[model samples]
Target: MRISTITNWAYGVTVGLTLLSGGAFILSARSADHERQAVVESQALDELSERLTMAAEQTSEDARLFVMRGEDRHLQAFRGDENGERDREQALKSFKAAALLQQEMALIQEIEQDGEALDAIEERAVTAYTNGDQEGARQTLFGAEHERVQSDLLTSVRQLTDLIATRTNDALTDAKQWSDFWGAVAKSLLGLTAAVFLGVLYFVLRRRVAMPLMRMTGIVNRLARQDYAVEVLTDNRRDEIGEMNDAIQIFRDNGLERERLDAERRADQRTKDLILQMMHRLQACQRQEELAEVVSLFAPQIFPDFAGHLYVMNDSRTALSSIGSWREPRRAGPVLTSAECWALRRGRPHVSDAAAGDIPCQHLEHADEMGICVPLSAQGDTVGLLYFEGASDSQAIASARLYFELIAENIGLGVANLQLRDRLMGLAIRDGLTGLLNRRSLDDALNRIARDEQGDVIAMMVDIDHFKRFNDEFGHDAGDEVMRRVSAILSETVGEAGTVYRFGGEEFAILLEGGAEGSALDLAEKLRTLIAATPVTYHGRLLGAVTISLGAASTTADMPSADVLLRADAALLSAKAKGRNRAVADWVERSSTDRRRA
Candidate 1:
């Protein structure tokens, strides 16, 4: 049965048993009260009977004394015995006052008659003794009617006492029996109630609640693990467990759907991995040939039924050029792209039912032709386009579109990486401070000039005089400004024929190509004079004008090595020794003329 049904029954039975037990207890109590009342009545009757016997004995003793002495003293003494007389009168009153006084009416009447007969006998004996009829008084005393009445009264008292005692004992026994029976019934009821409670608890916990809960827990675990094969056990209950079972069944169904979802997740992950791998291979191409190889590798793998190509824009961005091209392996003929190439270059995909008219090329004019073109962007600039063609199918084209975007992104990154590498190389070769060819790039320029058709090259080394004092007095920041202005002047003055280099602290070097010795010396002196005329100011302070000492050397076919650079260094020292601001030139003996101070 359902647990509710069983619970209701158990509750009802328990209540009924409780009421029955209560009724039994009430009956037992009433029986005990009745028994107690009987005992009280019997005790009262016994008390009355004992008091009457004592009263009779008192009267008889008084009468015997009166008869033996024939003295009014004995009668007066009896009358004066107020304590005993009061007790006898109280006893008689008590006998009459009993609750069942009518039931002992015969005993009471017997006692009253005996009392009257004793009074008469005592009077007759007193009269006889006073008249000197001692024999007659003896006869009256011995044959007194009070004797028989008193004996009969005593017998009745004994019988009444016996009845009271017997009834009290019977009541006591009955009270004990009733108490024992009720006590046993109470114990039996308590034991049965305990057993019923325990049975209910065991049945509910082990079978109904606990066992079902355990099975439900197991079902939940299985559901969590995505194992949907486990069966759910549920009784046809209208309680909480029934609701839980239905919920679990719903959960199991949902879990099955979740399994399908998990499968779709794995499939999507595989598709993502495939697209990523293809894009990664596409991005690794540094040259058009590498890109062509990537296309060849992916075209047959990704689009086995269609031809594919990658069309890149030229450096001038005027037209599209084919870099990578592929045809299906089964098709033996050369695939011409004159038909779709124009449409592909227009930054859109094209589909041709039959490649005719606007679709160029007789070879590619087919009804089954479908093509896709996606723009490749690098740093927000369109670098190229990826072109692909395949049989017209929704799923195939959809998958290809996903791959197309990834491929475009990959090519974009490749182009960006190459451009950045070239730019950084240029920055490395140039000076950060003056935008001039730094000392490191001078060797490269020197080697290029040496190999060039320009037959002779002049090298000059220059230094700023007292540049450290200028920095200390005016602060290094203003000094740096001065240096920048000087470097800029040198760059503008030298123009294209010469390249300036910052060669260590306060020193500069220049290479002039195919220049005569006089021209080289004149250029050096002009640089020196111009720098000397230019004064630098810092915070309204006139730091004074500055000048540069320059040294010049020439390199012919004979002095092609970098050693010729030292001649310009030696001449610069000579100019510095002569004065602070000047220009000196190393004139080959043939070019020497006048060595005038500048």
Candidate 2:
């Protein structure tokens, strides 16, 4: 109901109840007024009885005095004789007033009869006094007539007083009953009114307000606590409760969405963490076998039933070499054909799940071995392949393929890094112009050999004859070409027996193992002859032929120092000063050769 309508109804009820209670109060008041009138009448009747009794006593005394004295004076007093007549008149007036005040006919009749009896007694007593018979007057005054009058007077007054007392007591009883009845009725009406008010308040709050408010509060608390499972209760009446219910449903829906997002976020984090840990293991790999082991371990970590072989591509991509396979070696090696080479040369990731389709494999003689291949590429160049087998139940082939692509990417990066490190190290030690060991390598080699307690170690110093003239005549590029050619010749001649170093510009050094002065001098002569015979060509231009003068010494001498190598270099200078394109041996016997040169 509308509040205004409800309020109007309640007001009407209250006004009706008020009018009813007021009528009840008015009735009770009238009952009370009747009781008050009864009280006043009883009190007035008592006053009349008291006055009559006093007046009767006075009249009796006056009549007794007049009769006992037997005097006209006393008779006058009885009639209107000064003092006694006043008493008689007062008694008569009281008798008349008592007659008027009496409501009962029986009491009024008694009063009239008592008044006539008194009048007769008064006449008799007055006649006796007028005759001057004192004795007769006394007898008449105290006789039966006067006694009958007083007895009638007492009886009439007692009857009137008894009537007033009885009626007044009855009136008080009726008023008390009426008061208790009305009090009970008013109390009952008040209690009913109060009960109605409370009942209306309780009904209004519970159905229209309190219950819905409590439900809304409960929903709010549940939503605040992230409990999205609660259901909302609302009315069909299109009010705030309907909107609130809709809002709660939306909140639960949003909570479900957030929960889904949170789960996905955690899953992605786990994947990234696994990849990072896998990367850590990959970094520890030193050789191709170790890399294969890492890849194989990562396979099961990414997918179920993972078995695969890692194959590396050759420089020309015309060959596939299985670096590591996840099983034992077979009894025989399956021969790889040219078709497999062609597939590898195509240089793309290829998958084969079909029973009879061609897949590039050097060892695919068995039908049980089904697989797919993904290439490990670095900067668009295919470096290797990761081959995975299919499961017997179902192929996680698609997911496995994705994993292989990711794994291949990491593999490519790792291999590229390793190759780059090797190249950098090679560049650090190798001579840039000559492709031989630099001075640093020479120092390392000399130190190692000097520490050896072997049969012999020889050091040679070589100087190209007139290298400055060669550079000036043919330009620096041609000079560099000459140096490279000479370095190549020296390296080819020394083979694995010695280490060659480009010590500086126009100068080179060598550490020859297991060599005495004879081996050193023979090696130097070979280098000199080779350079004299060969000429370097640069940019299709013929550069002049070059020759190197050589000096040789041995570690066989006691406590030989690197300074002895310096003596060999000094000897090379002497040889170059004498002539070019010749070997000058600086052996123990070189002192005699040195004296001759001097």
Candidate 3:
């Protein structure tokens, strides 16, 4: 039952019991009062009967005295002793008016008649004595008839006294017994009320209210301390405590849910922090190797269950090769061609797991393991790949596919940025027309030679001989074509032996650093002969035989970059002054070798 209902019922029953007990006590008190009143009334009736007997006897005594002594004082005393209108008659009248029992009233009536008969005899004797008939009044006062009348009256008075005493005693005993019965009933009722109170205390308070409350107190305290692990017992009772137990259970459930969410939030924040750190390092990397190293270091921390590789697409964009790897991946190879992986072909993320019924990458040797390939793309162009394999659970990898793709994106951008920077650097230092190192790069090479003491460098300056004749004859396009062919010949003959630069328009410069056994004129003569020997063809027209004059200079010791170039230029002017199709050397100084003009 509900606690409210139980408590209400207890209250009502207790009140009713208490009221009944109080009523019983009230009845008991009234019974005691009635008993005392009965005792008092019985005593008053007994005292009235005694007084009437005394008054009648005294009237007879006073009449005898008046008849025997013939004294007027006796006669007066007879009247005073209640012979006429006395307290004796008044007692009779009061007894007749009282609420007496029928037998007691009969006794009182007998006393009244005996007193009246005695009063009449006594009055006749007194009246005779007062009229001078002494002998007759004396005889009447002492006569047997008078004695019989007086004796009978005294007997009736004594009987009335005995009757009053007997009736009073009976009344007192009956009143006491009745009072005692009611008092015992009151005491028993009070005892029953006490038992009811004690039963309620033991059963209702201790079992129903107190014990459950005690258990709930501990549960509540644990809940207050945020200990959701504490068990709250379910109570099926339809009481306040039962409702409280349910509420506590609910609070514990909510607390557990909150804890779970907080844990996930913390884990998510950790993932974000790792990603942030990886991205920052990526942004700072100057090379693809550095970017790969950054990815290798942080990717495992983000997803520990998987192992992966960082691949960089080769410059031709035809294939991707692993630059770095981490966590000992078992399936994918170190190199993957563009066609070997679907992610590279499609430029998107692809999961490769034959167990999951997905197409596997060709580079994966064993397709039993799950793998995810996120194409590292920037500006819609795939630069590289991030391949993770060895995950047993495909769902695990797929769930975090977004994070993997994000990592791939940043690394791809880094790789693309490095490639772009290298391209830009190449454009800055390379010649646009002949595709040879420009003047700026040649100057830098000479500066390095100047910095290196005890270094020998040979400077050869070659120019196309009458290169403007073709531009004037067949147009500048043919001239441009001739220059391009001559530049290619110079580069091809020099190969790895020296440095070639397009010094200016229709002019070429070469630096030969490694020791050449033949004098510098031989290499210069070979270059001039080759240019003259090769046929030049452009737009279906042969631009005759293209020839070149050469000026060559060699440094024996410390390289003076400016002085050597000036000597080579002066020698070239000398060769032009000598006649066009020939090679010349600086004549002021000579290495102890044969300087033959070719």
Candidate 4:
């Protein structure tokens, strides 16, 4: 039964028992009142019997005194006793009204008859004594009839007293017995009520309520401490305790679910932290090689089950090549064409899990293999490819596919940044018009050579003879063509023996390391002759026979490395001063100047 129902039943029973006990007590009190009334009435009847006996004895003694002493006082006392007979009569009347037993009433009537006869005898004796019949009065008072009547009256009074005493004693005994019986009944009923109350308290309160509550208290304490792993047993009872158990089961279930959610949240946070760390590392990378290394190192940490290669697009954009691989990937090889990878072809992510009925990428060695490819893109241009294979489960790959694509996107951006930086560096160091090293690069080379200070340095400065006349005659396009043709021949004739640079416009400089001055002059003359013999063309027409002035200088221990290019320029100006289209060496110019001074 339900606890409420049980308690209600207990309450009802206790109330009923309490009421019955109360009623029993009231009945016991009523029975006690009856016993008390019986005792009181029996005492009243006994008192009346004693009064009659006393009156009988007093009148008879007074009559005997009047006859014996012949005294008027005795006569007067006997008359008073005779007048007291009315009191005796009233006492007899009390017996008849008391509702005594019929047998006892008959005894009272017999006693009354004997008392009246005795009273008649006493009155006649008193009258005789008054009429001076002292002898007759004495005879009357002491005669056998008087003696018998007196004895009989006294006996009847004694009998009445004994009867009253017996009846009163019987009433007292009966009253005592009745009082004791009802008192015991009331006490028994009260004891039963108390026993029932105690039984309910023990059985219902202690066993049903207190014990179950105590057990649930322990469970609640554990749950409060967030111990969701603790086992909660099922309760099938149909009581309030059963309801509490079901509630506790629900609470435990909720706690377990919360714990699961918390664990998942913590794991997701950890994964995001790793992703953030990888992104930071990727951002810090300066080269495709370094970015490949970073990706290889962190990809396994991020997706341990996957093994793949980082493939970057080649410089020609023709093919993709793996820069790094992790976890011993076997399905995806070292090189893949753009058309071979669906991810690169479609410029998106593609899964190649054959077990899942997905089409395999053409780059995979086995058609039944599982893999995922993400095309690395930046600024709307797909630049590289990420191929992952060897994942144990397709579901694992599917779940982390987003992170793969995210990592690929960031890596693509990083690769794009590296390529852009390389292109910018190349532009900054190369001449835009002639495709030769610019002045800045020449300075950089000179500074490097000066710092190393190894071997003799030859500096050649060359210029096209009257190069602006071609622009005036054939337009600036023709001048540009002359410069281009001459620059190309210069570069081809010098080959790897020297470094060529276009300082500006038609002016060019070359640096050769560790060459003789004679060799430098010879190479300068060869360059001057080769350019003069070579005809130049602009559009479909031959412009002229283009020749060039040349200046050559070499580094000496006494000369600062920075003065070599100036010395070559000075020689070229000398060659120009003498005549155009001639070659001059700074040493030869110096020698001529020395001779002129000498």
- Stretches > 4 Å off in candidate 3: 1-36, 52-78, 81-83, 86-88, 113-277, 300-308, 313-322, 325-373, 379-383, 387-401, 419-598
lDDT of 1 by residue, 1-598 (tens): 6677788988988887777777777777776787787678677767777887777677667656777776787777666654345455677677677644354666667667766666667667766777888777777766746577667767876775676577677777888688778867866777787777788788866777888999899889988887898887656877767878899998887888888789767766765676567678756666556756776676565555667656665656655566666774221123334333544346444444344334532324343455555666777676665666666676766756666676567766665565566457658887767677788898787777656646678889999998998889888877887788789889988998688998877788998877788888888888988888887777788878888998888876666546557888888898899886888877743245443321
- The runs of at least 3 residues in candidate 4 whose Cα sits more than 4 Å from the true structure, single-residue gaps closed, are 1-40, 64-74, 85-87, 96-99, 121-284, 296-309, 313-373, 378-401, 416-598
Could you tell me how far off, in angstroms, the CA of residue 405 lies in candidate 4 after the best superposition? 3.1
TM-scores, one per candidate: 0.40, 0.44, 0.55, 0.54
Give residue 410's lDDT in candidate 4 (0 to 100).
87
Candidate 4, residues 217-254, lDDT tens digits: the string is 99999999998877778888899899999999999999
lDDT tens per residue, model 3, 469-532: 8999999889888878888889898888888899998888998886452656678888888888
> How does residue 104 of candidate 3 score in lDDT?
72
Candidate 2: segments with Cα more than 4 A from true spot: 1-282, 285-348, 352-371, 378-382, 387-403, 447-456, 588-598
Residue-by-residue lDDT tens digits, candidate 2, 1-598: 5544665677677677766677677777777777787677667666766766676666667678767655555555566634344443454455455434346556656666776577667667667667666677677768787787788877777776777678677877788678667766766767766766776577655665677778878988998998877776645645455566677777878997898788767755665677777788888776656777776666565654656666676556566677666544331132232345333556666654345566535445454555566667788776666666646443455545555677678987776666666568779999889888899888877676657655577788988888897689878888887888888899999998888899999899988777666667777887888889986788888777788898877764563755657877877877877776777766644678678999
The superposed Cα distance between candidate 2 and the true structure at residue 407, in angstroms, equals 4.1
Would you list the clashing residue pairs of candidate 2? 76-81, 77-81
Cα lDDT, all candidates: 0.71, 0.69, 0.82, 0.84
Candidate 1: misplaced stretches above 4 Å? Answer: 1-37, 69-77, 80-89, 101-103, 123-134, 205-207, 214-231, 234-238, 264-598
| Higher-scoring candidate on TM-score, 1 or 4 | 4
Between which residue pairs do clashes occur in model 3?
Answer: none
